[model samples]
Target chain A: MASQEIETLAQALARLPGFGPRSARRAVLHLMKRREAAMLPLLRALEAVNERLSTCDMCGNVDTSNPCTVCADPRRDVRALCVVEEVSDLWALDRSRLFPGKFHVLGGRLSALEGVRPEDLSIDKLLRRVEAGGIDEVVLAMNATLEGQTTAHYIAERLERFPVRLTQLAHGLPVGGELDYLDEGTLAQALRARRPVS
Target chain B: MASQEIETLAQALARLPGFGPRSARRAVLHLMKRREAAMLPLLRALEAVNERLSTCDMCGNVDTSNPCTVCADPRRDVRALCVVEEVSDLWALDRSRLFPGKFHVLGGRLSALEGVRPEDLSIDKLLRRVEAGGIDEVVLAMNATLEGQTTAHYIAERLERFPVRLTQLAHGLPVGGELDYLDEGTLAQALRARRPVS
Candidate 1:
């Protein structure tokens, strides 16, 4: 009943994350139903983002502004830079509201099997930023994966010459986590990192 | 890390059917990544659809033209009218290529508990169309639900005076459907509608 143009649009929408063939067609129809209220606004927002968005040259954070809002803000502690593997992680951490510092996105962890090398990531850029003097600590807030650990170790070794403190997120039972469902590795790490009643 | 505007855009994108908060943010980033390849084309498609689309007065099919592509096509068999519950169903039936006829969308099935009245649907319009003559067959291609059957029966009673033959889709195990998992009702229907082992 719809036109070929609409069909083409549905096909494109299918390629987006979380959209399959059925859902893509449904989404296209939903968009058509909300033509004025939602469709045009989404289109306009996408256009605005496309026109102005880019990765931050300093920290690799994604935003419409060149340096990104975080890097541009003076209130953030320049002495403490939290390192993450991706912008999504950075956003997650931002939502956590635990960190009051800036960030450096490595883009991805070093994966030898996947051909992801240290040079493949923004590691050099991060090193340069840290080398410029001002940052006193680098927080390794990478994911709890082997590749993440490898990247963290590599970065720590590289930053050994610099006079900055190196730290990482503690390994423990996650907040609201169930001990019965936890793996042995996590349990052992939690036990090893446990402190007295204080 | 993104500006307030970009963040607002991501929030809006999150409201789409298949996209959650995280995937919506990812979708905005994806749109930015594929600005030329996907975003522009999708935007153009939405604009074109908005500019030209509306429901066909004849069949209730939503498309870029007033009469809709199906109703406007002279090649379609106007004599065999297929009735469906919604435009999405119409689209799905159209995709099947099994029926080469026009359509009538009822918008929704009768639901006593939900306070759905016959006057709330396009039943009057359908009756008027049928009364005008030239239609030889009317296929009640509604979903095989209690409400759908109720609607079909009501339509049949209303058009009792019409000379057109009334028909419906057959009930059976779906193509590639496993018999072991099928419901007793479906198995009984499949047995009743059995043909030569072809």
Candidate 2:
């Protein structure tokens, strides 16, 4: 249906998290059509990132710099550290502008089925960061999955002996989540953690 | 939320047909994680295509070769040409292997809303191809939209003097379309084109 180069590009694109074969094909066609406006820019950006990409030595966040933007920023609160499962989680949290602190990426959570044990993650690095002593609070902002909770709990136990306070994200109905469509666990959590009217 | 290079990559990816900001971010992260497996291959493919890309002078098809793969294939029925609105349409038609003939891409259809005129397309070139000789049939394989039909009609009018047979794709229910879910226009077309049972 197309050239080998176009097919290869589509195959690589289809491997992305949200894209399929049809969408990848569409994307390839679009890129081919808009070579100057889209294709060249994307190629240049990818090459630049690939050439300069590095992980933060302090946290596990990926950036062109060794310390990452968040870790190197003096304006960010060094006393408050947020722990997350991956770099994407860190980005999601940072996008909110609510957490004015640095982040620690665990690389991945403990998953028995996937054989991702505690040793597989950057737990020792996280412990080392806490032990280095200036952080006041450690927020475990893991997902609401069972594995996420298990990882949070394990991290909490390790940080208990440290002077810094350990906290996890509050579980309840998400903003704009319809009560009728929500699951029983979410409803129960929302009810148990009900807030008083001001 | 990310560095300039990663953000630029995400923005460029988001401009793709099916991708949005969120999906683009996820794709960027995926690319970053599997740089060797995914990102480098995509970059290399893009570079190779960019450097070697050419349009067929005869058929307007895009390929590394000037004649393109379809136009260069000696086995294809050159006497029977399939005219389509875009390169993507040509690819779609060829993917089915139902059209053994060559293809001519119009670049786009006549669209009053978008200000696309007949002159803006490859219609003149199409007429030249038909005028230059031994073509027996020209299949008008435009989309089912109003603009598509209008463009097809305009082309048919221009080709009325030519000795070649001009044909079009049939309008009916799609292969897997359900009768209950089908629109009135399709149902009417299907009924009007009803065939005798074997």
Candidate 3:
């Protein structure tokens, strides 16, 4: 039936983050109705990107090349490494343009409920990369979640025996955010990590 | 060059109703990250639908055939016609399951500011269809906006000489809506179009 095709399309669309069945239906209908104006170009772009894309062999970033543009670039600091949970997180960091170091994607955090262990992540590969030497520092830019904290702790502890300096992104009040508006946890972290103004 | 691609994609996406550059970038990044899971299927679906789609010669609705399924179907009531501003509006009416008549998509509402004239729309085609005879009624189901009202008035004036009965969707408080919560304009419309409750 015609409904079946719509249903299949809806299901596929629903798999996208923040899209439920109703939104999926609306999106699918919009795409189908505007096939010429919007859908065709979108389709071509998707096809072109998919045909060319691959995972970065060095740092696990999604790219069209083996090591990814970031890892392959000679100017980027391979001596400094930033670690993150997902490619999205890595992309977010890249968008900030604050750090000019190489990256290691952990894929996911240590979550007992989800049965995600360190071995299941790229932790072993990270250790191998770290032990190979010449790396000056490792920045744990994991999420502020409990699992992320635990993973960072585990990684830091494991690297304590190694010669590389370990650092984590500073925890504090967000820029442009009022102190009174801060959550209890963030406020406490900000207080604990306070430094004298330069 | 890479930034230009992102910018172009963002601009294209932002042109879609309800999507801005932030959402467009999120969507593009999501597609790029989940190339196999989301992007490939979306691309294939878009391509498949685009390849098969054609505008209905009679009704301007996108379909796999020239006349469209609705226009081609002999079982549908040809004596009753429903007029709407857009194909989406027609689809909404169809979903209601109350209307068994054929549809006339006006493509857009009358907007003097936008320089959208009646002739620029399918008004001539609609008049031709109406003049062909056998139509008992023409239901105006344009939106409740200023342009929608203006377009409805233009259509009504144009078809006033015809022998067909003209009707519009009843205007009142929406289902599950409280009169106290309605805006001044809505309340005025509801009051003007008040009916005797059984």
Candidate 4:
């Protein structure tokens, strides 16, 4: 009976991104024994987030407000937009503090195999935002993968009639990454996209 | 400024049991971008657990009550006691669904090098509970480590005068563990502690 309860809890925990059945079982047992310390808190947090959270209408990022903090901020540059596959990509770019522009989350990459088409993503909304004018550049900061590249090319082509300048993040050896450690595909891409020294 | 926030969040996340700084940064960014979906839930859980949580006075385990559910339950075998070091350990044993007895949490092992003395742990409470009588057996289910063994020995010596039987979990090769993969210490100990087949 106790194991049944544990199994149910484990299933619930397995719904988390990185948690599998084994990890879920470990976590559930860990939480149950430390009920006062972790379980109740986690439960409350889940409930609270479920009740209070919303999606940012502009960026499609999850937030407590309709327009997220970044979208609502008047000081942020609206004309320079960074495009990404997911909110996680946007967060990664935000953490870099290199770009001082707004973001457009595509929700997911264009995956023909996965049946994700252009309309399935936020591409229509992105086109509308860009065609509204005043936007100078669109930085395609999607992952350096086939689906990411395909999505980027598709978006770029869609905006070909517009006056917006399009660009992508440089493809090269990552910072502190060794060439020997890099995968063959990445190495090839890095070599192919190499730029001449100034 | 954004990097600093990410760093701070990463540090906070790194304090979780299994995560390191790199994983913490990844988790923090994931949370931030999925603020509504993940971060808000985590924050609420933390707050709820912090606010509503309390430790069981009897066993030093975390619970919503003073004595805790285990201690309060009349169905549990009070005369058979299982001893463990941390609250997490107790929870682990509980999930096994074998023991039907009450528990005594020692809180920590006896580490002479670390200056963790018998008095530093809940050894006094353990002695008191044992001395109060009615206990048929006291199972020392502490981890199979030097400090844990030392702590178990101390408890055994203290209860030598009492009529209660002392027992311990069998130590040997773990289930599904290969003999070739066994560490030298574990192999040696297993050989030394070998028992005849019933």
Candidate 5:
């Protein structure tokens, strides 16, 4: 018979994004088998993250510090700000190490179907950051989805009055993308944005 | 920038049986977003399970109690014991509520490729439980895999001198399984084990 505590643990794991009931059951069994080698270390790591978890006051990024690592890093380009829809997006971009700038996580994109509006997000906080000045450019690095574009457009309109230069991520065929496999919209965008041979 | 604590949490999650690096990152971000609603409860549950986790001295099953819920249940049939390769198999069988008997977890199947011997499993403990007397029958409900069958055969031979009756699960088409989709071995086994229409 499954104990109440083990069932409770499985239920909690099932609530996570990717895990379903079967996978949660398997994971719990796996953890129970390797208590010292796996479960204890994971428990300790989770406790540490939970205890120190904090949000960046200026940029809405979740981290263990008030200003977050990116915001507090003096070596990062203060003049360039990358605005993203969520902390996951921030992480994905930061992982590439291509952008040497601070990030502002908007929490989520504006979704009309989901009843999300400007006030629901950290848009005002983003505006306030720009208003405080010294940022030379604001890159709207939102996703290419309908809601993402809508949110980016809304933010661009709001930042129109500011002195900072506004830009968005360019749309094009992805690296190693086969022309036959690419969608029509992507093909059109790639053709329109085609540059002279380098 | 990803904090050390967050990275550590992701790495821990990645080490789980089904999780990869990408899914681990997504899970961490999801947990961070709903820290109070999700992460804290999971942490508490893990801690609770970890604090009380114990191996059943009787059946080699894992539970918060030494005897395990199944072993301690007086309503269960003491004369019949279902033998399985792992705790997961025990849980799966018990979940069906079809087995009124107790269980004997073998810990793992004997495998020549992996160098697993009979001594590596809880076969001795199981034999001792039967030798102590009371069991009228032993059901070898091992998996259909080669190693599982090999282990079952070995155990059956060892228990040949005992007073108890020996039995095994039937090989047949799974409930709702299509005949055309079945493997040749499974079809052959099903044909070989065909019973009366009644």
Candidate 6:
């Protein structure tokens, strides 16, 4: 008979994203198929992350170190900070090799419907970091979603009196995205911000 | 920014069934989001499984102990033995609770196409177990695939000298399967194996 431990492992796997009951079972079976090469490494990795993983106190990005690799790096521009809704967005931007500046993770967007308040986010720390005076620019790189825009507006208002100049990531049809699939709001905004041929 | 550790963790999750680059990244984010509740528990579970999970020496079923809980159980029918290609099949049969007998996991089916030989499977051990004899009946529970059938036929030939009554799992329209979607092979098998109404 299948042991209780296997069932419990499947239950835990089901809670992870991209896994349902069937997929969890499949994953467990696959793990059983290769206990040493795949499963053991995964177990060890999970244990390592569990022990060492923590969010940077300064930027709110999840990392192994407290200050995070990006925040701790001397090469990155501390004067220019990119503020995003989550750590994933920060990673995506960093992966592009376009942003050499440090980041501030907002934790999540302003979701009044979900009863999330400004206090729920790292906004206060962001404002304090900006007001503490070395930062010259604040890039509000929240998503284009309604809540994201709402959060950006709220942050912009909060930082109105600060010496730091505020900015936002551009919104338009995504690169390589089909024009036919582009929403009306994006199309309108793209047209309004249309650049002339250089 | 995402640290090297988080990236390593995501890479490990990607090796598991159903997770890819994007989904692995998402899983890592979700883990970071719920560190106290979900991630920690998963780590502990993985550690537990890693430390304890092993194959039973007698039955070849994966479990926490050497002989496994099922093989050690005295109440289960020792006379009837269900033979399957993998531990997963044993688990499936056990979950159904239709069989109260013990199991013998063959590890894998014969597949010349995939370079899997008779020597690759635990067929010798299975034969040894049967020859030791208290096993009155042996049920062949391999999958419906070509490899499973080939393996079953090979095993039947090997067990020809034994006094054990050999049988197989019944093939038919699945309990809830619709006729329209059923293949001709299944339909024919179902027709051939049709039973009288009680």
Which pairs of residues collide in model 5?
none
Q: Give candidate 5 misplaced runs (Cα > 4 Å).
A: A176-183, B179-181
Clashes of each: 0, 0, 0, 4, 0, 0
Whole-model lDDT for model 4 versus the true structure? 0.75
Task: State each candidate's chain A TM-score.
Answer: 0.95, 0.96, 0.88, 0.86, 0.93, 0.94
Over the stretch B24-95, how does candidate 2's per-residue lDDT look in tens digits?
A: 998898888888898888889888888878888988888767778899888899899999999999988998
* Distance from true location, Cα of B111 in model 6, Å: 2.6
- After superposition, the stretches of candidate 2 with alpha carbons farther than 4 Å from their true spots are B112-115
DockQ values, each candidate:
0.51, 0.76, 0.38, 0.18, 0.80, 0.62
Candidates 2 and 4 compared: the better one by TM-score is 2
Question: Candidate 3 residues B97-196, lDDT tens each?
Answer: 7888899988888899999998889999999999999999999999999999889999999999999999998877889999788888988988997789
On the 0 to 100 scale, the lDDT of residue B148 in model 5 is 95
| Candidate structures ordered by TM-score, highest first | 2, 5, 3, 6, 1, 4
Task: Estimate, for each residue in B122-171, the C-alpha lDDT of model 1 and write its tens digit.
Answer: 99999999999999999998899999999999999998899999999999
Evaluated on CA atoms against the true complex, candidate 2 attains a DockQ of 0.76
- Real interface contacts reproduced by model 4, as a fraction: 0.03
Give all TM-scores, in the order shown.
Answer: 0.86, 0.96, 0.89, 0.78, 0.94, 0.88
Q: What residue pairs clash in candidate 6, if any at all? A: none
Q: Which whole-number lDDT from 0 to 100 does residue B25 have in model 6?
A: 88
TM-score for the B chain of model 3: 0.83
Per residue, candidate 1 scores C-alpha lDDT tens digits across A25-58 of 8887777777787787877776677678787898
Error of 3 at A57 (Å): 0.8
Q: Spell out the clash pairs found in candidate 3.
A: none
Q: Candidate 5 lDDT, tens digit per residue, A1-198?
A: 788899999999999888998899889999999999889989999999999899889888888778898889999999999999989899999999999989998989899899999999999999999999999999999999899999999999999999999999999989999999999989998899999999
> What TM-score did chain B of candidate 6 earn?
0.93
How well does candidate 4 match the true structure in TM-score terms? 0.78
Mark the regions of model 3 whose C-alpha exceeds 4 Å error after superposition. A1-11, A20-37, B1-15, B73-75
For residues A1-198, write the lDDT of model 6, one tens digit per residue.
Answer: 556787788888899988897788878878867888778878877777778888789998888888889989999988899999988898889888798888999999999899889999999999889888898899999999999999999999999999988999998779898989988999998999899999
How many clashes in candidate 6?
0
The best candidate by lDDT is: 5
